[model samples]
Target chain A: MTTFFSVAYYTFIENIRKKIFYGLILFGGVMMGASVLLSVLGGQQTLRILLDLGSSAIEFFALLGVGFSAVTLILEEMESKTIYLILTRPVSRFHYLTGRYAGLLMALYAGMLAMALMHVSLLLFNGWVFHARYVLSLFLSAEKILVVGSVALFFSLFSSSAVSSLSFTVFFWILGHFSGEINYLGTQIPSLAGKLAIGIFYYVIPNMQYFNLRDFWDVPQVMGNWVWLSFAYGCAYSAVFILLTVMLFKRKEF
Target chain B: MLRLLVISVVLFSVVNAELARGFAYPLAFSAADAAASYTGLDIASVVMGVRKLGADIAWIQLLQYYGTPEKPLDEDRAFQLSWDMTKYLFGAKIDKEVCFTAGCDDKSHYHPQIDGGVYPLFLQYCYRIVALDPSYYFTYLYGGGALAWNLNRPQEALLLLEHGIAVLAKYQHASVRDIHEPYWQLNLYVSAIVYRKSGDFTGMLSLLETAVGQPDAPNMIKGILANIYQKQKKYTEALRLWINIYDTNDLSYRRRAEEKVNELKKIICINPDFSIA
Candidate 1:
């Protein structure tokens, strides 16, 4: 456990030192400004447009942080053979993958926090009424991104660094949003075999619509069946895929 | 056993974070606007190069641009747009002169269209959002609704819905959005209603006729068509549809159908040649 924490802590420190982290945080702040610019284009939906832009900016930047920075941090170490040094010394494969995932999440958390603070401040300054639910929803939003990171990590084992990172990103985004379409297709194709195939595809993809609280930004959130359940489901799903990643690493040679 | 428990604990702890976050957000300090309001979608924004999701970026910006406090209502378009940054950050109400101006009548703040070529641009922005991500069905509904109802431009809404139906048919001709659609119907229902709103009731009737002919048209669509007939004073045709509604298990529909039937019977007794509708 200490080994895991130490690895995660150091990896976070190393990632924090990267210039891209600062660039991402800075871009999040710029999005707040962009919201003000955008709010003007909106007539009655001014406040909404502002917050939506802020929220989307956070999600977009965090996604980039994971794909461009987090995945690269892990894959590059392995690609450049730096993992061999740590693996030979005393660190196990499980520790390496888990620690890296934990560290990247911590770093991503910092980014999410900074951007969220900026976003909330802009909303407050604008006198916009917000429910405490934004926090729960935002946390879930971060979790969704982390799951994407886990997928990226799993892909890192089998593919090149760039390919792994980019593939997970495209997959995470499309599958998350398009689960609705998959459901639509499920009913369209009448063939029994086709229906079964579509059903499997739908279950295999992440249903991001659950965490899509943006459409309900102003609506108060209850720990209702959908909200808390979606959060729990995300964690369980991420854990399984990440465990699969660990399993893949377990069998890999130097 | 311990290792499995440890993993479960860790994952479970992540779930707890949501509970903790719900309690802490209100304590956060409010922040002022960090930067000045940018003018139009200037060269800077345009040239920045959308390394990804260009249409989405443009779509969001378009939303913000329309929602801004000093919506472009001023007689002098360029001058009104030049409202100082302080005016925005300070949260000043729109200038009286701007509101009184011809293009700026937004008393309710739901100005879907202000003159100065802004409102009409709703369709254009919808075009951009759709072009960027063609599978986004809701945008079509939104763009269709705004144009048909708010802007009084059902023609544009019809065209947009036409495109939406074509695109959606490719992926979701059949769907499970129960309240939104029933099976393969209502994809074209949106466009049909827009026809009705634009005073093309004949066009609306014809579209519904086509929908009625379809083997899978939902009952809701059928009821709506029947109601339109009642409004148009087609008593006999409406009576037959009302009987269908009365036969159904829906109490509310049944009650309304019975009342409508009784009223239509009296009208039919007076006018034998009631083809005026």
Candidate 2:
């Protein structure tokens, strides 16, 4: 456990030190400011508008940061042969990959922390009410980042460059939001063949929309189970991707 | 030992937050961005005072704010926001996507959605935009037109159009502003429809009067105003405008004016002061 954490700690620092990390953070801060500025266009809807903008900015920038970092930290290390340093140590490949994933997750959390503080401050400054549900929304957003982080790591193993892996991760992130509708269509289809084809498409996709709490920020129906259900779903989904990533990494000559 | 405790708590808190997240789904603080009393408009009020340019930027941000919709759950709401925001801010007419032409009876005519909840804020947004840049003419046209035609809230639409007319009147009269006399008359015409809907007969006549009185009123204005009076059964008033249009000799309106003048002559001859309504 200690050996695993040591790698995680090292990877976390390396991920945070990147220039893009700072850039994403800076961009996030600017978005927070913009969200507050745009809030007034809302009239009586200002609070909901601000909340949506603030949270979305955080999610968007943080997802980018995670996607880039996941690809770069893993793919770059393998390419440069620095990954051997950890693999040759007491750490196993599973631990090494898990550590790297944890590290990237931590870096994302740190960024999310910064964004949340800025968003909360803006909310307070604007005399907006604080809803505890925002924390859940932010948490779900972080979980989404983690899921995308794992996806980025998985894609990096097969895809050659950071760009390709990041691209795949973003593509999946977008497609996952449509998973619910696709799954609904599967149920609607009459043929068993059609249902199976769509069912496979539905489950195979990460269904990242499950973690989308932004839309449901105000709506209450069918969300009673979101807390445990999304947590289990996000964890199970990310774990499967990470396990695949670890298995794929083991096959590499490095 | 204490350091370990701090780390343990940090990890536990992270885990607990997720647990509560699922369990709480939407906790108290998340449901509403604020209590009923706490609105961000107060902050906007302050920002507009200090940052004049920021207000302009804020207007853009407002469009951005409006365009950004939460998803999965907010798909409908956000979709409306983007649709309306585009139309209101940019003057892009958004046709209802679901409408079908003649053969399909059920979907033949499109009824633009009127989200009652979102309707009230329409005027408020347009007012703020104009307040920031008083000369921004499109805001008034698009917002006022939307309120009247789309939202079916004619009263609010009339108020917005009137405010726009008032703001442009001085510059419009001087022919200095980009807003021309036709634009003024068009706004009044839109207001006239609102007045007609609200059962305000005098208001509708007043609107037509205002349009007809414009120095640069279109050559057809007298005919149009006369037609309105003819429908109201005010043959005397109708005759007067018809005569004015007839004197213009604008071929497009002359025939209609002459026909209306003859029609009104017969009516006035019958009673000398016949006012059907």
Candidate 3:
């Protein structure tokens, strides 16, 4: 457990030190600040505009950070041949992979939290009354990042190059959000082969709508059980990809 | 690798099935509708999962469109007059504006005198906005109110409000009396418009009064009610409502409210028992 945590800590520290991570966070802050100016355009809906744009900025930038770090963290080590030094130690490959993922999450979550704090302060400054849904939305956004990061990590191992992996990850991200549309199309199309292909894609892709609690923040039907179910789905889906990533890592020559 | 893949697939399938049964994803707008009203930013909003932000952008565009003064129909008039002379001389055919009406009260800001007060594609803009984010209740209220009151097209307003009601039906609570209930509020707006259409000024005033009394009633609605009160010579009531609107600090109504408040104060000072005869 200590070794696991140590690896996670090391990965977190290394990832946070990257210039891209800092740049993304800075950009996120600027975007959140810009939301205040944008809110004026909304007239009477100023508060709603601020809330929507601010939270979106945080989630978007955090997702970018997660995608970048997930593809690069282990691949960079492999390319530099620095992974051997860790593998030669007493640590197992599974621990290394899981620990690195955990660290990536930690770093990204920390950045998200910072942006969220800035958002909350801005909201409060503008007299936004507190709501538990804000916290729920932020938490669900983190879960979404977890699932996407895991998918990216798996692609990093499965694909031949970092560029292809990043591309595939982004493709999946887009597909994931449209999972409902894809499923609906599956039912609409008459061709048997097209239906079969869409059905496979539907089940294979992570359904990001599950973790899109922000979109449903004002929805009255989304009760506590639904939240828990979505949370479990995020964890389960991410675990599936993490397991696949571990399997691929175990087979590598290094 | 085969075992791992099987495990991953099985795990994903199990959780996915459970989630699918427990939670329903919100339905997106139909592709046909989205394409019909597709602005460049709207396509990005749909793909990027920022529908609310996109709705905000569309709302701003809608405001800008409405804020700019409508172009005069001078060219259309010239063409019509020339067409009449041509018909008198040579019997030439000319198309006339089908929806034109005469004697429209140009003095009223809310009443659109030409083309039945319908701005070109105003309803389409409202439809596009609601399609992007149905939960944006303000779009429904603002667009519906403008259509019914300013455009003098109560039918279009009712249509918009009904769409809002249908889309937001799931959000309705068991108690319909709640002021914060978006469904109930929309119904109130619909009823007020219906009363106005039927020429029941008293009924319309009562409904507007009830609506503006709600804690969450928009300042725009309050401004409307205050205007009605002033017209009816209920200076004290109008003054009180204007003060309330002024306190809300809405940019659209604040200056007007301040002017009305001061004007009403002087009227009351001249006659302490001021009332419409």
- Which candidate has the highest DockQ of all? 3
Q: Of models 1 and 3, which has the larger DockQ?
A: 3
Better of 1 and 2 by lDDT: 2
Write the candidate numbers in order of decreasing TM-score: 3, 1, 2
- In candidate 3, stretches whose alpha carbon ends up further than 4 angstroms from where it belongs are B1-8, B30-36, B72-118, B170-180, B270-277
**Residues B1-277 of candidate 3: C-alpha lDDT, one tens digit per residue:** 4676677678667778888787776546655345337688987876777777788888878875665436554877556554543342232333432111245544322222334334867888888888888777887888778888777788999988998887776445422443247887899999999999999989989988998887667776787787778788998798889889877655545555665777787877966564321
Chain B TM-score, candidate 1?
0.37
lDDT of 1 at B39: 29
Expressed as tens digits, the lDDT of each residue in B1-277 for candidate 1 is 3466467547645554443344221111112111112224422322221211333455556554544434535666545544532253334544432221236565643232245333646777776555544444445655665565446677787777777666545434333343234213445567477667777878878877776555334334555666667678787777777666565433323434555666677777865453212
Which stretches of candidate 2 lie above 4 Å from their native place? A188-190, A220-222, B1-277
- Give the DockQ (C-alpha) for candidate 2: 0.04
| Candidate 3 DockQ vs. native | 0.31
Q: Is 2 or 3 the stronger prediction by DockQ?
A: 3
Q: How accurate is candidate 1 locally (lDDT)?
A: 0.62
Q: Give candidate 2's whole-model lDDT.
A: 0.63
